[model samples]
Target: MKNDVKIRNEMLSWYDAHARVLPWRSKPSERPDPYYVWLSEVMLQQTTVQAVVPYFEKFISIWPTVHDLASATQDDVLREWAGLGYYSRARNLYKCAQAIVSEHDGIFPNSVKTLKSLSGIGDYTSAAIASIAFDIPSVVIDGNVERVISRLHRIDAPLPDSKTIIREYAQNLFIGDNTDRPSCFAQSLMDLGATICTPKSPKCEICPISKYCVAFEHCDAQVYPKKRKKSKIPEKYGVAYIYVHDGKVGIEKRPEKGMLAGMVGFPTSEWNEDSVDNIDDDMSAYKIRHVFTHFALTLYPQIINQKTYNMIEFKEVDKIGLPTLFKKVWNMIESDL
Candidate 1:
């Protein structure tokens, strides 16, 4: 196996000049805060960096430290994390914060193994927190790094299956020197993959590591880190009952398990594979479609002007922290009222 010394040096040099200035990231001259790094990493799971910025800022402003977060109620955290999808992360984040405060004296463990023991933290997140926050030389391979490495070696194996090979190569790449900033080295690969070796229409002409890329030699840089075709997503359907009276709307808490658990939403019919029947014309105000990871949903929202049920004032709907699916339904029907 060839040494990654030259590749590492070139990539790190490019990163120093062009690395993204993100809210959670620290400049090379500064030390990263573990709290910021951990919070950002959790929010970033199955989410884009662009979407995570405002949420991270808002979270830090509200709960500046792990202790503050641990002291917060899970419902408040869920509310703050509203619109950011992947609700489970918020729950796990709350659990992990509590664990850190109660068990570890509010200090985030620097080692990957100990970090993994926290709620919601897995291999990749632990590696990221260890390397970026603590400057530990742990192997960190996110989607971007996988793409870059797959292209560099021109590996044709599809992702998931190719994950082991990709990780092996990434570990090898980071093995050469301890003196080099491990944090910078790991983030450089991530930056390269995100900005230059993008999934579609990679900007190979200006890529700093293009000289070392085997995929570039064959003129197929975009083709590395192959993924299998996605299976068909089944459609699920439901009807939302929106009851409003005296400037208030009725909302209910979802069960503490399954989709949108413990989040506030307007009362709704059961979501099922089959469609509902005998829907009245006046009740059906609007129809909205939302997509989840495993399925798509078509929700029929019905408006009922009634004061029988307990309600939240319309002006305070923001406090409910409804998930994106319910938020979309609200947006669609809120205008008519």
Candidate 2:
């Protein structure tokens, strides 16, 4: 057997004995449920596993199946998915559930090509769902897998640019394993990168496949997945106008396009790169800052003795689907009330 085959076998064997027991993952003896797989994969995008656990449990508990989720209102879904940033995923999750129920008769498509056609199921997500849930042969490469591949081959190219090379390298691992469990093989790579071959200070000593890792041999595993220098993130300024009446706060749905699109938030001024911060001494309650993927936002909360027709009870704020940025602003202003 080739070195790649040896590495693959060792990785899967390590995974079988030490796989992280996540709620959505099926036991080794059982096949995974496609709905749970798709839902967990969607929730895990750009979000940490710790943050996604409660949200995943809540969503699965409330909407047990695709059909149940399809019947749920978009507002309810968003509410349940609050705090797990990337609100568009919640929107797409609803649409995908509906599509699965109506288009595919409530059954998740087992093929990568078919899964890709679903809303929000991109190339990576589709591969993940096809391989993990259905036991199909598919190349699943996320950030973790990319790091592992880059280190294993000592690929020096910077990320985003090196992604194609890393993916091709990862693809070879799952190519001829007809008898092996492809799902375990794919997930093991992910888990290995997550736990052992981490981006920073990787626990190389305990890494199962460290013998085959080119970067590890050279003592440069941390530097394998080189990344381009990020451009300075621009800062945007805005004011969140908090209105309270009868113990309810004013919240409105943002426009269905642009930042925080279609999510619930307090009324605010435009978040512009050059926007001036017009904070009055009496009106300004607090200033809060949040960093997004592309930009940093500074929001000045101005409390008013006025009320808008749109009001949600302050005690019920947890039930409303407020994005992380808005939630931070709310926490700052809520203390004043």
**What value does the lDDT take at residue 95 in candidate 1?**
100
Model 2: per-residue Cα lDDT over 1-337, one tens digit each? 2676888789888998989999999988998999999999999997688899998999989999999999999889888887887888989999999999899999999999999998899989999998899888888888988888898899988988998887777667777434278889888887887788888999999999999889989999988689999999999888888899889999899898888888888999988887555575456557788998899988888788778978888988866878888888777778678
TM-score of each model, in listed order: 0.96, 0.95
Q: How well does candidate 1 score on lDDT at residue 132?
A: 93
Q: What CA root-mean-square deviation does each model show from the true structure?
A: 1.7, 1.8
- RMSD (CA, Å), candidate 2 to true, equals 1.8
Predicted model with the maximum lDDT: 1
Off by over 4 Å in 1: 176-179, 280-283
lDDT of each: 0.88, 0.86
lDDT, candidate 2, at 81: 82
